[model samples]
Target: MFNKILVANRGEIALRVIRAAREMGVKSVAVHSTADSDAMHVRMADESVCIGPPSSQQSYLSIPAIIAACEITGAEAIHPGYGFLSENAGFVQVIEDHGLTFIGPTAEHIRIMGDKITAKDTMKKLGVPCVPGSEGGVATLDEAKKLGAEIGYPVIIKATAGGGGKGMKVAQTAKDMERAFQTARAEGKSNFGNDEVYIEKYLTTPRHIEIQVFGDGKGRAVHLGERDCSLQRRHQKVFEEAPGPAISAEERARIGKVCADAMADISYIGAGTIEFLYENGEFYFIEMNTRLQVEHPVTEGIFGVDLVREQIRVASGLPMEFTQENLKINGHAIEVRLNAEKLPNFRPSPGRISQYHAPGGLGVRMDSALYDGYSIPPYYDSLIGKLIVHGRDRPEALARLGRALGELIIDGVDTTIPLFRALLEEEAVQTGAYNIHWLEHWLETNLGEA
Candidate 1:
């Protein structure tokens, strides 16, 4: 076990790591920017250091400043909680080069899986299912048209280098393929710094399902199960739950086994998520998140496991204490992300928090850094907190979540609470018949009425 570890992020996740480290009897050092001088994570950690100014490029994302903090604190490892440098392959290599452990996957695994195109190729080679697409980057307009025709109409042109929902476009007719191809290529070059593009068959109504896998360094891997993250907006997940109502036990077993095998084939280490788009009884690999996800607390609640602790144990050359047989998911769990945004249209609303109060009860859990008089800076993510609820069944969980959301109150900023409240009462959510587009369609119908 590491005597000390430095956390390379901010907000609730930073505080989350600090709490876990303290419970395990490990010292934690928190690195923060000038903007977060009095943040909760700084106050909770065993030690703190100010890296730089408020801008992410100069502060949270500053590689040299972070390494200096770790060296000065004599920390043996670093835990990047989600965003920022969590998935940066270069950062992982730098940490290893400095003889410091990065508490995630190896640099090789990160490099192979970081790029979207490379990841798709690797999954296909490993016998994992992937969406039918271009074999490599399309070199000419003729190649794009030929590929589009073979894949059928409504194909999505995507950047082979990077993604942000940018450098991507869809064409429904053959006549429009040439124009869309040029536009996507230009956008990709401007946004991602790469003009390479590929085409893939796009599903109009697909559900996003991801399997969570934990692996030790020596080729031992197991999956904790899957999460249904279909409730999203503009590719950003808002609500998530465990044990998707859409998948059966047989289907879950098949997908979980394949995901575990794929991770082992890549020599993947630590905790990671293998994402898939489930549409017609088949799972097609989309991408793999090489770090802990934002909605991981729901999985922890149902399984009664400490993922952070497990991550540390694996990085320290210790075998996982629990196996596939020992793991058992107890019940239904749901997490509603509370962000500083509007109800229907999620526009950022950042300001001071006047009255702040979180929900409480037997099955309710709140993870946040919110406090009275705290000002939400506009320079960072708009997330305010996460409300997770667990119950013996889906209905019970939904009801508990409704009650919890009703209890939550935050004044002086627009929030998504109204939207969640309306959603819990909708007939689709009550019967679990809603797909990925349900929320967006519902929003369009009741944009401002809620």
Candidate 2:
């Protein structure tokens, strides 16, 4: 294995990589912006580099700065812990050009899966199920209107390069088509620099299911079951559970094989997630994430494996440690995001954390960067931590999650902990019958209940 690797992100994810590296006897180099000078990851890594100021463009997202950090630290590889340049194909190429290794999928794979239309087309060609809609980008209003009519009402317009619900809009009828199409295109341009939009049949009651697949660059690959990330707000996932409460063993095996086969066909490498919309016992491809996901802990909890360690081992040209037959789902696991945001309005709340206490117990894992005196800077994501619980079954997992949430405490800033606490009381959430739209509807009617 390489002696060192650089973690190219911040917050809890950066610390996740650093800890994984440390366990494998690999030193880590952490690159941070000025705002994160006193961050946990920076303090834990074997070496640290101040990349730039608080601005992400000049700091966390700066290619030259990250490359310079790797050079100065003699880091042999980079582990991009999601977001920023994690899916940027150009950054992967640059690392290779500098004679450094990138601990993820090949640039070609990233390029193919980065664009929505291309990925959908690719999945279709590979015999994976997909939502019915436009075959490609709709360049003009006339074409969009024509396609919308043909696809039927309640279709959604999405940017080819968009994510996080920024460039996605749904139109219930022809009259709403023009606005949604234009707004989706504009949001796409402003958020991702790609105005190209495509239409897809919107599954109103589908659940968000993502299959986690890992490959060894060669043609070998395996799937680690699925995570139900249906709970979200403004397109950001808040709660995720593994071995989807709604999926059966047969369905899990079938879809798991499909995703693993697809990754093997492309010779994918490292960690990747293929997201789908599941409804009425059928699965439709949505998009694929080419890096580790924020909710990966739930998967790890049930599988009894270290994904980060596996990612690093694969990146170092090692064969996979286990086969599909060797892997088994041990139990049910649930993960709830803990963000520093005020409820009701969901506004950002950043300030010093006067008091902090992490829940401790069996099957409970808290991955956070918060401290008693650390002042949360206003320059980054509102997420402060993730609380995960694993139990022998779904009911036990839910109970553990409730107990754990009750024990967590953070002062001086409003958080979303109460939101999750309220969710546990809902019959829909309790029975695992909640759909993608469940959280929004719940928030609308029971805004103050949490």
Candidate of highest TM-score: 2
TM-score of each: 0.96, 0.99
Task: Report the number of clashing residue pairs per model.
Answer: 0, 0
Model 1, residue 311: what's the lDDT? 88
Candidate with best lDDT: 2
State the lDDT of candidate 2 residue by residue for 137-196, as single tens digits.
Answer: 999999998998898889999999998888999999899989999999999999988899
Candidate 1 TM-score versus the reference: 0.96
Q: Write the per-residue lDDT of candidate 1 for residues 1-450, one digit (tens) a residue.
A: 999999999999998889999999999999989888888898899999999999999999999999999999999999999989998989999999999999999887887787778889998888889988888788899999999889998898887765446787888889989888999899889986889988888877888899999988777788888999998765678889987889888998899999888887777888999999899999988888899999999888888998998888888788888888888888999998989996556889999899999999989999998898888888889998999999998899999999999899899999988888988988978877767777777777889421
List the candidate 1 regions with Cα displacement exceeding 4 Å.
Answer: 448-450
lDDT of 2: 0.94
Following a full C-alpha superposition, what root-mean-square deviation does model 1 have from the true structure? Answer: 1.8
